[model samples]
Target: MSASSTRPSYAAVLRMPYATRTFTAALAARLSYGMVSLAVMLAVSRATDSYTAAGVVVALFGAASVFLSPLRAALVDRHGPRRALLPMASLYAGLLGALAAVSWRPGAPVPVLAVVAVAAGACTPPIGATMRAVWGELITDRRLLQRAYSLDGVAEELLFVSGPLLVGLMTGFAPPAAAVAVSALLVGLGTTAFVASPAVKGVAVHVARAGARTRLGRGLVQPVVVAAGVGLSLGAVDLLVLAFAEQRHHGENAVAWVLAALSAGSAVGGLLNGAVDWRMSARLRLPLLAVGLALALGVAGLAPGLVTLSAAVAVAGLFVAPALTTSYLLADESAPPGGRVRAGTWVNTAVNAGSSAGAAAVGLLVGRLPLAVCFAASGAVALVAALVSWHGEASPDVRTGEAAELVR
Candidate 1:
C-alpha cells in the first residue's frame, strides 16, 4: 500500500516513544497556559473597574514578555528546560496571584496594577521557546519534527479556544476572581510537572556562548522574515474576524466562533502538514502559501452565516500552523548548536509583532470601511507576504552534524 494510503492509526501514532511522554508534557504545559489565558484578563478588568486599563496592563505584560523572551530562551539553551522552567513558572504564578489579590482590594492603585502586569508579562514563561528547544533535542527527522510541531499547533489552538470558553463560563457562574485563582494554581502545577518530565530534565543547554562567533547571529534572518510574513497575515485575518462579526450584527460570541474556526482549521492543517513525508523545496512551498491564504480570506468574504463563515475561516487557516511549523523547523536546522531556543524566540517575537500590527490596522480600517473590504484587504496583505517569501532564497541546511532532531 502507498504510505499516504496506509496511514497509521491514532493509537499507532500514540505508541511512538517520543509521542507519549513528550506530548504529555506539551499538553500539560499548554493546558496550564490556556487555563489562564482569559482568566487573567477577566480578573484585571474586574479589579480595575475598567477594561481599558486592564487591557493596558495586559499589553504591558505582553511587551515585557516580548523583550525578555530572548534572554529567557538563552537561559533555556544554556541550562535545560528543567532548570529554566520552574523558576520562571514560579515567578509567573506568584505575580498572577499578586495581581489578583491587589486588584480585589478596594484601594489598589492603578500604577501598582500596571507594575504587576509588567511583572506577569516579564515572567510569562517562554513556553513556546522552551518547547521548541525540546523539539530540537528529541525528534531527529525533519518530517517527524514537522508532525510534532503540527501536534503542538493543535494543542495551542485547543488551549486558546477551550481555555477562554471555560474561563468565561466559570466567571459567569461563580466569579472572575475564582477563575483567576484556578488559572494561577493550574499554571503553577502544570509548569512544574512539565519541567520535571524526563525529556525536559535530560536536556543539556549549552552554557557557553561560542556559537555566536561564526554566522550564528546571521542564521536568524531568514526565519525572522518568514515569521514576520506569517504573523502579518494572521494578524490581518484576526482583525478581519472582529470586523466581520461586527458587520454581521452578531454579538461578541461571533468573535469567539470566528477565532475558534480559524484555530481549529490551523490545528487540522498542522496535522496534515506533518503527516506528509515527501519534501517540497522552499520555492514550491512559499508560493503555495499565497494561494492557501487567499483561498481562506476569500472564504471570509462569503460569510453568509456563522456556520459558513466558520467553515471558510477554517479552510483558510489550514495553512498557518503548518507553514509556521515548517519555518520554525527550518530555523532550528539553521541555528547554531547552542542557539536553538533563541532562534525559536526570535520567530515567536516576529509573529507576535506582525499580529499586533495586523490587528491594529484592520481594527482601524473596519471602523471606516465595509466588512467585505476589510477581509479582502487582509487577504491581499497575506498574499503579498507570500509573494515576498517566494522571492527570498532558501538557506543551506545546517543539520548535517546533529545526530538527532530537537523536540519535546
Candidate 2:
C-alpha cells in the first residue's frame, strides 16, 4: 500500500463509501448507551424521591449489561449483526418504554423498576463492539485500523460529554420520563439504520458451537484485563478531580474546566496517535501506555494548585485514548478465529466492570481518606494493570489467510 493509502486521514476514513451511514447510525445507538443509565437514575429519583432507589436501578442496569454483553456479541458473531441487532434493539426499546411508564407513576415500586432496568440493560445491542468488528473486517490495513479506532474513541468521548447534557436539558424542560423516552427513540432509530447499512449487512457470520469452545483465549483476556485497569484508573480520576476541586473551594465551573482539560488532552492525543505510523506491537504498546498513564496520574495527585493539577490532568489524559486503542488492537489480534465480536465485548465488559469497581471503592474512601491518597490509588491500580500486561504472553500466531477464512 502507498503511504497515502496506509496512513489514511480521519477524513479519508469517513470518505469510505459505507463509512457515513454506518458511523451515523452507530453514533445514534452509542449516545443512548451513555444516556440511559443517567436518565433512568434521574427519572427514578424524581418519581420516588429517593437517591438510594435511583442508585439501585442504575446499578441493576449496568450489572446486567456487563454480564450479558459477551453473550450478545456471541450471538452477533454466529448470526450476523442484522439478525442479532434488530431483535435485541426491539426488546431493548420495549424494556425502556416499560421502565419509563413505570417511573412516571407516582408510587412506582422500586423492585419492579429494578427488574425493568435489568431487562433493558441485558438487551442492549453490543453496537460499539459490533462496529469495531465491522471496521476490522472491512479495513485490512493495520495503520488505517489504528486511525479508525482513534476516531471511534474520540467520537465516544464526545457522545459521553453530550449525552449527559442532553439528558439534563430534556429533563429540565419537560419531565424526567422525557429523557428516557428520548433515549428509547434514539436506540430504535439508530439500531434500525445501523443494521440496514450496507457495510454492516455485508459482514459475514462465523458459526461456532455454543459452549466453552467459544470463550476468549487467554491471550485476549490479558489486554482486556489491562483495559480494565485503565478503566479503574479513569473512574478514580473522575471522582478524585471532583473532590480535589471541592477541597480547593473551587466551584462547579472550576471542576468543569479541570475535567474539560482532561478530555481535551485525550482528544488531541487520539488524533495525533492515529496520524502516526508506529512500528511497535500492540502487546508492547499496551503496557507502555499503562505505565505512562500511571506515572502521570500519580504526579497529578500530588500537584499543589489548580494550575498544576490541570496540567497534570491534561498530561495524563494524553495516555487514555492511546491505551484504549492499543487494547482494542491487541484484542483484535488475540481473538480466536471466528471470535472477534466476543473478544471486543469482553474488553468492553472488563473496562466497564473495572470502572464501576473503582468508582464505588473511591466513593467510599473519598470522605474518609485524603484526596491525594485516592489519586495515588488510581495510579496504583493502573500500575498493577501494566504489570499484568507485561507478564502476559501474546496470542499464538495464526496466518492472516487462515483467520480470514475462519471468519468467512
Candidate 3:
C-alpha cells in the first residue's frame, strides 16, 4: 500500500457505528465528570470556606484515582469492560450524590466530607483505559488506531475547555446541590452508554493458558513509566499556570480562560496528529514538545498581562496531547498480545500518579518560592522528559515493524 493509502482518516472511523457509539459515551462521560468537578469545588468552597480545603479535596480525588486505577484495569483485564462498568458507575454516582447531600447538611463534619471525596475519587474507573480498550477492539489498522486516538485527544481537549465553564454556569445559576445531582445523572447516563454498546458487549476477556500467569506482573512497564513522567511534568505546568494567575491577581474568572487556552492548544495538537502522514517518530515528537514547553514558560514569565500569558500558554499547550498520543502509541506497540487492555490501564495509573505528585510538589514550591521560579522548574522537568524519551531504546514491537518494512 502507498504511504498515503496506509494512513487512516478520522472521517472513515467516524462512519463506523461503533465509533459513533464510543464517541457519544466518551463525550457524555466527560461532561458528567466535568460537571461534578465544578459542583464539588463549589460545594466544598461553600462548606469549608477555604480554597486550601478545596485543594485538599481535589488532591484526595487524585490520590484515590492513583491507587484504584490498577485494580480497575485488572478487573477489565479479567472480566471485560461490560461487566466491570456497573459497580464503578453505581458507586461513583451514589457517592457524588451523597457528597452533595452532606455538603447541604448544616454543620457537616469536615472529616466526613474528606472521606466521601476519597471514596468517590477512588471509585472512578479508569475511563481512559476503558476507552482505549474499546478503540483497540474496534480498530485493527495501526494507522486507523492512531487517528482514533487523535480524535479522542481532541474530544478530551473539548471537555477540558468546556467542562469547568459549564459547571460554573450551572452552579452560578442553580443551587450547588442541584449541580452535583445533575453531574451524577450525566455520569450515570454516560457510563451506561459506554458499557451497553454492541462493540463493548462483544468485548471478550482474555483467558491465560493454564501455565501462563493470570495476572499482569504489576511492574512499571517501560512505556508506562515514560508516560507517567510526561503526565507529572504536565501537572507541574498546570500548577505553574495557577500560580501565574494568582500572582498576576487575575481573579477567579481568569483561571477558566487560561485553562481553556491550554486545552485549545491540545485540541489543535490532536488535529495535527490526525492530519500528519506516517507513524510519527518519538525522536521528532519529543524534541518538538520540549521546545513548545520552554517557549510557553519563557513567554509566561516575561509577559505581564493575562492576554500575553494566555497566548503563550496556548501556544505551549499545542504539544501536550500529541506527546500523550505518542506515549499511548508506544504503549500500544509494546503491549503483549492479548495484553493491550492491562497495558493501557497501567498507563492511566501512572499518569494519575504523576499528576498527583506533580501538583503537590509544584503547589508547595509555589507557596515557598516565586511563581516564575515554579514555571522555570516545570519547564526544566519537561526538557528532562524530552531528553530521556529521545535517547530511550525503541520497543521491540516497533523495531519489528520497521525491520519488516525495510525487508518489503
Candidate 4:
C-alpha cells in the first residue's frame, strides 16, 4: 500500500513529507539532553571530589540552558536552523568533549568545570523548539499537527526515561566521562543529519527586523501562563512525592514506580488526546485542562496509601500532556509568521522557570507545613492560573474573534 494511505494514527504524522527523517534526527540529538545531566553530575563529582561542587556546576549549566533558550530560538527563527543550529550544535558538542577530558581525571578545578558547563549549556541546540516549528512548517492540517505534537511529547517523555538508563549502562562498563563523550557524539552526528533534511533546510528565515516589529497577541498569554502553572505544580509534586515516600518509610523503589506511573499515564493521555476530536476551542480548553490537573493533584495529597496516591498522581498525569499540547497549539496559533520558534520558546521558558520556582518554594514550605497542605497549595497555584485563563477567554476579544478555530 502507498505510504499516503497509512492509517489515521500517530503513524500518519511521521509519514508526512520529510517528517520521518527530520523527526528521527531531532530525537537522536535530544537524547543527549537526557543523558547529559546525569553524566555531568557524575563526571563533576568524581572530578571535584565534592557533590556540592558538582551540583553547583550542574545548576549553572541548567540555568544557562533554560533561561537563555528563547534567545537561541530567536536566533534560529531569524537565521534559519541551518545557519544557526549547526554552529550551536558544533560548539555545544565540543564543550561536552572538553568537559569529558577535564572530568576524566580527578581534581579538576571546580571553577573551570563551572565555566565549561555554563558555556556548554548556553550553546545547547534548541532542538525541541525547532522540531515543533518544523511541525508547523510541515503540516497545516490542525488534526495532523495535533498528532505530530502528541507524538513528539510522548517520545520526549520516553527519551528522558531511557536516557538515564543508557547512562547507567555505559557507566557500568566505562567511566562516566564515556557517557558524556557519547552525548557529544550523538548531538554532533544527529544535528548534522538534522540540518541536511530537505524539510529542515526549507524552513523559512524571517527578517530579523520584521520579526522584531511584530508582537504576539493575547492568544499566546493564556498558554504561557497555564504552562508555567503546570510546570510549577509538577516540580512541587516531585519533591512532595519523595516526602510522601519518606513519611511512610517506603524504599526508593516505591518512589521510582510511582514516578514511572506518572510518566506512563502522561504517555497514554497524549496518545488518547491526539485521537479524539474535541469541541472546546483551545482558548477555552486550556483553562479546563489545568483545572482537571489541579484537582487531581489535590486529590493525590489526600490519599492514605501509596497505591491510592499513585492512582491520583496518575490521574494528574493524564491532564499534563493534554494541557501542554494545547498550550503549544495555542502558541502556534498566536505566533507571528516565522517567529513560531521564539513563541514556543517563551512557553518553554515559563515552564522551566516555574518548575525551578515551585521546587524552591515548596522546599521551604514543606519544612514548615503539612505534606497534604503543601500538595493543595501546589495544586492551588495551577487552579489560580486556570481561573485567570478562564477570565481571559471570557473577554470580549477572545469571544468575538480567534475562538473560531477549536484546536485539538
The top-ranked prediction according to lDDT is: 4
Q: If scored against the real structure, what TM-score would every candidate get?
A: 0.86, 0.92, 0.85, 0.94
Worst 10 residues of 3 by lDDT: 207-216
Off by over 4 Å in 1: 1-19, 105-107, 205-219, 302-305, 394-408
TM-score of 3: 0.85
Candidate 2 residue lDDT tens string, 1-408: 122464477877777668878999999999997788789998899888899999988998999999899889888877788888899999999999999988986678889999999999999999998888877766777788889899998898778878988998887788787789889989999999998988887774432333224546556756787889989998888788889988888887787788888888888888888888889767777888889989999899899999999999999989888888878877877665357788888888888998999998899989898877788889889999888767664324322222222222
Root mean square deviation (Cα) for candidate 2:
3.3
Q: Please provide, for model 3 over 202-239, each residue's C-alpha lDDT reduced to its tens digit, 9 standing for 90 to 100.
A: 65444122112443332224455555666676788776
Ranked by TM-score from best down, the candidates are 4, 2, 1, 3
lDDT tens digits, residue span 278-316, model 4: 777878888989999899988999999999999999999
Which segments of candidate 3 are over 4 A away from where they belong?
Answer: 1-7, 50-52, 205-222, 246-249, 279-291, 367-371, 394-408
Q: Which stretches of candidate 2 lie over 4 Å from their true place?
A: 1-7, 204-215, 394-408
